[model samples]
Target: MDSLEQLNQRLREGVRCDGDYPPVPGEGNPNSPVVLIGHSPSGTDAQTGRPYSGPAGELLDELLAEAGVKREELYITNLVKCWTWREENGLRVNRTPSAKEIKEWVPAWLKPELELIRPKAIVCMGGPTAQHFLGKDFKITLQGGQWLELPEDSPYLKLTGHRLDPKPFVMGVVQPNYLTHLQEHAPETYPAARANLVADLLKIKRVLEGKLPKPKAPKQEELDIPF
Candidate 1:
């Protein structure tokens, strides 16, 4: 098996999809017990050549600090390695990746990286990422922060074509970028979103440290309440 470094190098030199920016590799310790997955890189990330290093990145750092987790202690990556974009008024505007683009990249890039890192817990930030791993019908508004176990025959595992020695615990959280926008434009929703992000990260920390209890399904009432 190629090492994580080797696989990352391969990805760096790989071809980018049409209308996509170059791939941005995950950062932080490969041996970290937790992994954070986001939807994709933004224009800032594409320019910085780093995942989560823009305004959204700042929000993430703040949330992680509030949760008592360090940015350097968790492996951070995106669902899609490349930046999906469109030219808008002579400037490249970041756009959400299509399902086809996501499907193509996972097996080719993200899956291999996961196989090598083998994190104990995974926090999927944003709807697309959560849906990608959890299933097509996943609703982050209802399910954020709820712990879930990957089934033995999960489609995600099948898609990866890699067997994880110990299946990682998974949870969903709101995207930092969305939260930032909320903070600026929808002040009323910002506090709740920020609280939810911090709480979710704390849960991930507990899971990684083996302090969290066994997983259970969220109640209907719990699902009804937005996080």
Candidate 2:
């Protein structure tokens, strides 16, 4: 089977949830620079078999648009291919999948999805997806907003960072959900997070276009929002 077909088969068998993956792998622009990774399919997303639905997705789409990356120009996926939820007092509440679960499912399908897309950079949306895509050692507080090498033995089952003709760099960022939270609860941190995200996207763009100068990460002050 071709890579996409193989990826779907793994998703069906590996992820222990009812959510369906996108009917087919999204046809991202071959020129896309970043792969946006999330943790799992939300309830609506699972039923629809699409990544990012409802308000969260709309916010993410807006963020991407602000960064000059169109939806069609980027690839998106989740650490777990299906939605994992539990019934709580008659309501289904989402829970973060366990580390063991992420380890089990991501390698089988998500990694293959990355291999097929072969994006220039991987932008993990939150700590969980970041950790899943990079390795157990991945840390958001320590490593967020910087480019780093994907660890050896990553679940990118068929995708090997060591084997890349030109290795792709991985980046971590605050998830849109957290961004929304910060906007509501701790407005102080919102500007910085948003700035960091845009800066990272610009850096990714420059690197992909061959204009970047050996990855000189900008300092926090340099990322100050232009007003």
Candidate 3:
């Protein structure tokens, strides 16, 4: 797919992940410097064809604004195309997707998206996303704001339909949805999570600006040790 039209065509006619949702909005540039990857669009977002249109998105917009990043500056998307939700006790609750669903659909659409957008940094929003991209061994509490280098042969590249070349770095941050939970119950931790989001955003900014090189790998000594 050489253009957005082709990409959308492939997503619609070529691949069938979830048809309940609308086509992903925004012209996801393969050349964008940063990419913010999250879970599927929330109920509101799915309806509007915009990522993060709900409460969590509101928090994300606030946090990004604080970090001096505009919504248009970075490419944003989700690992899953449809919301995995069911009515529970008369209210709808989002649930983590089954492994089978991810395995089947991720490579078909989401992974190719990363290869196409080739962001300088990919901020995995929550544990599910981090687990998908970083691996099952990833512990969000310990490594949430820390940087991990992409594998030597990982597909962080700009694809000219077939050719792929290194394009950007990938990073992880606490998901805004997680913070929305904290904001409702654990108000104290909410600020810290938001701060971490801003700090991570700034770190990525510095790396992109050439002020800081790729972050060094975290050592055991730097692990989060909550006593």
User: Local distance difference test, per candidate?
Assistant: 0.77, 0.64, 0.62
- Candidate 2 off by > 4 Å: 3-16, 19-27, 30-33, 153-165, 207-227
Q: Using Cα atoms with residue i matched to residue i, what is each candidate's TM-score against the true structure?
A: 0.88, 0.75, 0.79
- For each candidate in turn, give its C-alpha RMSD to the true structure in angstroms: 2.9, 5.6, 4.5
Q: What is the lDDT of residue 94 in candidate 1?
A: 78
The whole-model C-alpha lDDT of candidate 1 against the native structure comes to 0.77
lDDT tens digits by residue: candidate 3, 77-163: 776666656779987666666676666556666656766675556677776776566554556666777767654333222211323
The candidate, 1 or 3, that scores higher on TM-score is: 1
Of the candidates shown, which would achieve the greatest TM-score relative to the real structure? 1
Candidate 1 C-alpha lDDT tens digits along 54-100: 88899889889999888998899987888888899999887888878
**Which of 1 and 3 is ahead in lDDT?**
1
Q: Report how far residue 45 has shifted in candidate 2, in Å.
A: 0.9
Instruction: Show model 1 residue runs off by greater than 4 Å.
Output: 17-20, 152-155, 218-227
Clashes of 3: 5
How big is the positional error of residue 179 in model 1, measured in Å on the Cα after superposition?
A: 1.4
- What pairs collide in candidate 1? none
